[model samples]
Target chain A: MIGRLNHVAIAVPDLEAASAQYRDALGATVGGPQDEPDHGVTVVFIELPNTKIELLYPLGEASPIQGFLDKNPSGGIHHVCYEVEDILVARDHLIETGARVLGGGEPKIGAHGKPVLFLHPKDFNGCLIELEQV
Target chain B: MIGRLNHVAIAVPDLEAASAQYRDALGATVGGPQDEPDHGVTVVFIELPNTKIELLYPLGEASPIQGFLDKNPSGGIHHVCYEVEDILVARDHLIETGARVLGGGEPKIGAHGKPVLFLHPKDFNGCLIELEQV
Candidate 1:
């Protein structure tokens, strides 16, 4: 099952402006940006008291966020990540329950360097749920 | 500043079906449904170790979720809630930082029986954020 809410990801058309908003406006501690080639997103982490916010920008034209932005135009909440003790265990259980795991059902290295799997939105009531091994 | 992530709200087409998916499929501990008339939504809470998942369904046609469902049809993530120590202090700070507080800048009694206010998505990188006084 899901553990702590690891981070909530927001896809932004402009990452710098988004980061500035969190830093200057919200007075949040904004972390440096890192490119997640596997996920095709350049991400900035906003450190909060109990959780983190991920600002995602399309790394390339083929980035998944690019498509989301194309449809949404203004960018928006892209996904929510939940931590799990063991992602493989969670994946197996979710698969048995008929949840479609995105990306061939294999765990990929997420922003935190943890193995992560994404559950299909349709299976999770329209929200893309990310399960990351803690 | 936020204290902790209280819950992530997901707007669902059917509350029962969504609850079943978490309870039966995900093996999560699901709570009873509650009608939040003021919010115009019926909600079910999914308890987790570090946070909760709130499943929201339109209580009436006038429900704000009704508009989201009409566009998404299948349902999806609605908003992310973060707990704050003092809501009024946080609200003033956010306002000074140029964040638009939704609903005329007044905190309403939310589902948890706590004061909650929503910030506009445009001000927060297109992610609708809810701050609750814990």
Candidate 2:
């Protein structure tokens, strides 16, 4: 069962600029500015009362953010993460339903020290989704 | 300040099919099958622990869902709703910051008996967002 919304990940052309906009314009507080070299991207997290907002920008040319930006032309909502009680169980359930896991192995630590995994958009009718265990 | 995530609205070609899939595959319980004649769509709401998932299908040919489906093709996440303490204040803040409101008016009762308003995606860099006062 879905627990709660953990965060909404947005792909931005510039993380710093977007982070500033969210903070100054939306009355949100920034939680982080972290770099994930493995994913070829950098992120800034904004904490909300019940859920957080993560702004993501490509760190390199081959990052997925670049591709998403190319397709949408404008930065937009990238994914919605749902908090789960157990990452492994959620992962298995998703896989059992023929959903493709973006990463080929077990759930790993994602941005902000949370265990997470991604389900491909292809299986969910073009909605990229993240499952996290907090 | 934001209260919590109220729901994530998804544009879909067929609400019944999508709702069934979510219920059967995700083990979620359905909360509503509502119609918003003004918005030209019918929606099905699936309640989660802390947030809800809304599957929207156009009721008329000129409905916004059709446009979104055309733009994304395979169907995808359309918008995220954030719960707020006061809808009027949030609306004023967004407008003061030069963000456009999709429907120019006060918060109206939306799906699941909540007062809500929408922010145009054009101002948000391609992300339609809703604000609900719960």
In TM-score terms, which candidate is top?
Answer: 1
Clashing pairs in 2: none
Tell me the tens digit of each residue's lDDT in model 2 across A48-122.
776777888888768878988888766999998887888888778877877788879488887657888888886
lDDT of each: 0.86, 0.78
Question: Cα deviation in Å at residue B47, candidate 1?
Answer: 1.6
Kindly report which residue stretches of model 2 are placed more than 4 angstroms away from their true locations once superposed: B105-109, B112-115
Off by over 4 Å in 1: none
Whole-structure CA lDDT of model 2: 0.78
The per-model DockQ list reads 0.65, 0.61
